[model samples]
Target chain A: MNRYGLKEKIELRINHATHHIEVDVRDTLLDALRDQLGLTGTKRGCDMGECGACTVLMDGKPINSCMLLAVDVMGRNIMTIEGLAQDELHPIQQAFVENGAVQCGFCTPGMILTAKAFLDHCSNPTDDDVRQAISGNLCRCTGYRKIVEAILDAASRLRRGKRHV
Target chain B: MKTFEYITPETIDEALELLGEGAQILAGGTDLLGEMKRGLATPKRLINLKGIQGLADIRSIPDGFLTIGSLATLSHLAEHPLVAQHYPLLIEALQRTASPQIRNIATVGGNLCQRPRCWYYRHSAFPCIRKHGEGCFAMGGQDRYHAIFGGHRCFIVHPSDLAPALMALDAEVRIAHADDSRIVPLTDFFVGPRDSLTQENILTRQEILTAIRIPVPPDNAYGTYLKVSERKATDFALASVAVSIAWLDTQVTHARVVLGGVAPVPWRVKQVEEMLIGDELSGKRIERACERAVDDATPLRHNRYKVALVKGLLRKALHAAHRSREKGEK
Candidate 1:
């Protein structure tokens, strides 16, 4: 059904790499990232904005890629979970691993990315702040106690200027 | 989602020229894209409004009104310092919206223009009246979350949290067309199913909402918004109330009580407002005033809880406003 529209060619910088792709106007950023660009780290849970599994950093702000049109993000910097780690895991990711915050690991990438953005603004957050910050990202496996601890631990590590991945 | 032609216009004039039949305006795309994916809306052309500049600014004129662009995202509005200090009701409502990620992408205009969350209307499988079907399934089907105040033929409840708060604050929306521009009260923006089942709002196909103008409240005005959702987070409200009351020493001088998730539009209860005026908001007076809010409610089969829920929410919201006024006095 999507084969009949006018395909538009747009260029976007995804994960610090530039790619030019032709996409239908109806194609969402989530579909373009996974199908066209082969960046499957961003999971599509509900395909709607109800789930945050498709959360990605659009121009340094976390947004749901599933709800955003790919053409709307043209010339903007797009960062997915694939861009979170360089040579090793980022601090928030390392904390998630150490704190055993991964149950099925489906919500890990989105959770860690959201944590990274939240921590960048607020390095000192209380338990309630952490809970409210990650309220958008749903985790069905863990009861979120450990996930909150992981984010708090990541904030502490970042405050100490610990560059260990 | 159905394939459609997309146009990103750079100016308001260009956008207005491009907007017409068979074209849908795309703001943050949080609501529009979801509706398209669910097959509820099928447009041949999609007009992306993000490219237009000056549509997302939140500016407050000195000692005058606060103008919030319609394209401003919920996250931005929730975090703005001026909004937090001046319009806490909007902040509270925006914070309790869909979720963090959705709020980051959902625009204020899009939130106010979102369609009803009725299961039958949303699902393409069922032919509902809103979609030009023969009958409304919720009229006789399961309508636990339907409206109790303004259910005529369709029983869908308005899904926006900000609309109620805006209406309570007496906000005005700025609409732009190709030939002219006009301002409309936020209260008159939404239309009922009885008025026109095909459209939920008064906005026509050729007009675009540009900004929201909120006049500065009186110095003694205190406002609060309370929502009772099924879940603590990321759920639509079962019943919600936004109350703004002006205090003269201790007596209530003016009040605006608006309810959400309980009607086709932002339900404003003038009887409750009139009852509260010229009287001190004591516990007994608040209880009595809240009871009057549901005097005209006509509940459906399963939504009788909403009548009681609205009363409780109204009472809680008034008490909150009273508390805020006390704090301000101190």
Candidate 2:
């Protein structure tokens, strides 16, 4: 039903699955992900782009979904917190849980996604590097100490997993 | 945000034809979407520029210039090898910009054309002069983050970190219209409150910024960007300095000192540059340059600290540039 109006039916390839959804041109990618697709894992914090709570992986790069229009990201690969785990918690998620990084659990999704994207490129990173990488994702809780520790822990864990493979 | 029609044009011709009153160009939507959400900007139509090809390329031209398309994301440019090798000062500024998430989505054109971060203008209730209102509320109201120089009727500072860095490098921008395009120096691209009360730049409604071109710096040229903020990460600069200097052994030959977060435009202090040129970057010379940097600064009630901040930043940046020369070559 694309009649060149305010609403258009667009296909979003989310989490290795494609879904056709009718969205308003004004709907942000965050709105479409949470309201339409029922992906509540991507929290809506400060609907503005200030807070990175609505961050997701747009083609494996962490971006604030709240700043993007749904129509603009039609065919891009969108990955939310829901897509991070298969049967068990992903290594990043496991490290977060093990290191007490999830205090209020509000900033965990965005923080993990940002950390995942950072660790993917940098197999070994210093504490300052991790801090600079995830500066966008703000966490009022945990004071970012445990979160930073968890990310470093996850990096080593991922490296061990790769060596085992 | 109100409901608006969105169209992605595939070519610059089609995009320019669609651009007019009541229409806004959507490059990355990092700034426009925020404005739309805050009701600071309301458009009847959005012309998304993502579909346009060849607008996001970063390449070195044959004319000894590095041309970057407008739609190129800030993160991509920051990570580009050419940018790192040629213009490290830009990378320094970009690393301190908004955040990783923002850098991933914010475009160079969008960053340059982004609206002011003044709280009074951002709020719809204020209706300040920049919003086509009667007077500026920050002139008397809370203006700790307001401009300290080149502010007349408006005190909002230009918020782009890239602008000052690019200005320090003697960059130019390409502006396209419906029929043809023209190149303008980056220094002339910005418009202060003395010229226009409602707009920040000289871009017309039908014009679009296509790309930015920066000349290849000389081998002896050294550049550095220093920003002072309340927080270490994810915060705008209170006062920033970008210094580009070329030296002949121990004496400065060419210099550009541009200050940000202190004026309606990227404030270039010719007095400081004049003091620096043909002189060795001695400790006493840096002190004199810092003094000249704040001679004409007209700070408001609450932004007097910015004058000091800019002075300190200029001192630090000049010292860094001086140290770079002592460490052999770039």
Candidate 3:
């Protein structure tokens, strides 16, 4: 057993793009996305899955990226914060901005991704539902009131089927 | 995290063959990865079972059993229409589990097989009795979350929210070895602290849990799962209760009361179940049963509050079951 570690080349389909990178067998998806692929938008807070800052979409469902190995996600559709915006800000991001949901901006990417997944499945969610949906992602700033408002606002805008910049 | 050889096995036989002394089965990697990162588990090889086919399906098998594959994630199980229709107790427990992100990846088998979240056992510095150390630190240390029942030498409480609900529903699990497999009741799968100090479940290092089999609930049966935790998401239960009862014309025909976060295993109160089998769930009857639920609980220093907490949960659960029976709710 080599002490330094063993590396394997694997292809990851992240954010609708395929990238083949050499990663250590022990490297988590969060590590690979940040270090190798330079997708630093996904933050890593409390890598033990307690904090959802490293959350990303795995097959249209939110999952903590830090708890999964880089090699584990092969041939699966993975979407991150970067995939939501094509030319302008996505509706969720716009709602977050308009509602002042972002204070430190550290948890923005993960919060947006989590809200996006929740709003995709539940179109008419109550305030309690949005609060429960984003319980995993923690923001020390904003006290979560604005985050809740942003998600509810985003849900209404999404129900209208309009993409606002 | 330490470097290890990771292999994705495409078959159950291949996965079992690869398991050995220094190997660990990786399912969902929600709990196992955390242990690896904390240096609590240092395996040389990781057998990733996600590549196996037919291990993540949720379908009805023969013999009126709805068999849930071991690899089925909690989110999928909670969102399954059949699960919601057949067993809402399971859905209630699953929704109150970790969080949406964790439920999306945490497997049902992995949830049942997860180690205790006891602070003493988790920290490497303590080396408590569960970790093969000399003595249990929680016995004399901070024991706010320790077990109030079934504590022999260790005081750690079982952390899984799904086990109690499954036990109440009389679920069975299939464990697979190299060439053979056996089905065991979900109640028998757990190992109490008195029986074994090192392991929580009866699964050997090589055996892998394959599927969970739940019989279709009987008609006129009402069940509910109630949990009390510090926070709504990403929190372990302080005290929880799962009650499944069947009544015909306001008389109890069957009852199963299982309590969690108060014992080393999901504490099944046959005493309370027997008390409710022949009588109706009236307010006085429920109060007596709730008091009987904690008669044998020997609380540690800081967890005496758990006795009252668990009793409160039992009262609420029984009341819910009572209301469901009255309204003819399935």
Q: Which has the greatest TM-score?
A: 2
Q: Considering only N, C-alpha and C atoms within 3 Å, which residue pairs clash in candidate 2?
A: none
What is the per-residue lDDT of model 1 for residues B43-155, given as tens digits with 9 covering 90 to 100?
98888888888999999988689999999999999989988778888988998899998888899999889988988998889998899997888877898999998888888
The predictions' CA RMSDs to the true structure, in order, are: 2.3, 1.3, 2.2
Error in Å for residue B72 of model 3: 0.3
Q: Sorted by TM-score, highest first, which candidate order results? A: 2, 3, 1
Q: At residue B89, what lDDT does model 3 achieve?
A: 94
| Candidate 1 CAPRI classification by DockQ | medium
lDDT of 2 by residue, A1-165 (tens): 122468888999999999999998889999999999999999999988877999999999999999999988987999999999999999999999999888899999999999989999999999999999998988877469999999999999999999999
Residue-level lDDT of model 2, residues B45-101, one tens digit each, is 888888889999999999999999999999999999999999999999999899899
- Candidate 2 vs candidate 3: the TM-score winner is 2
In terms of DockQ, which candidate is stronger, 1 or 3?
A: 3
DockQ each:
0.53, 0.64, 0.55
What residue runs in model 2 are displaced by over 4 Å at the alpha carbon?
A1-3
Cα-based lDDT at residue B282, candidate 1: 91
Evaluate residue B275 in candidate 3 and report its C-alpha lDDT on the 0 to 100 scale.
Answer: 92
| Best-performing candidate as measured by lDDT | 2
Kindly report the docking quality category of candidate 2. medium
Candidate that beats the other on lDDT, 1 or 2, i.e. the better one? 2
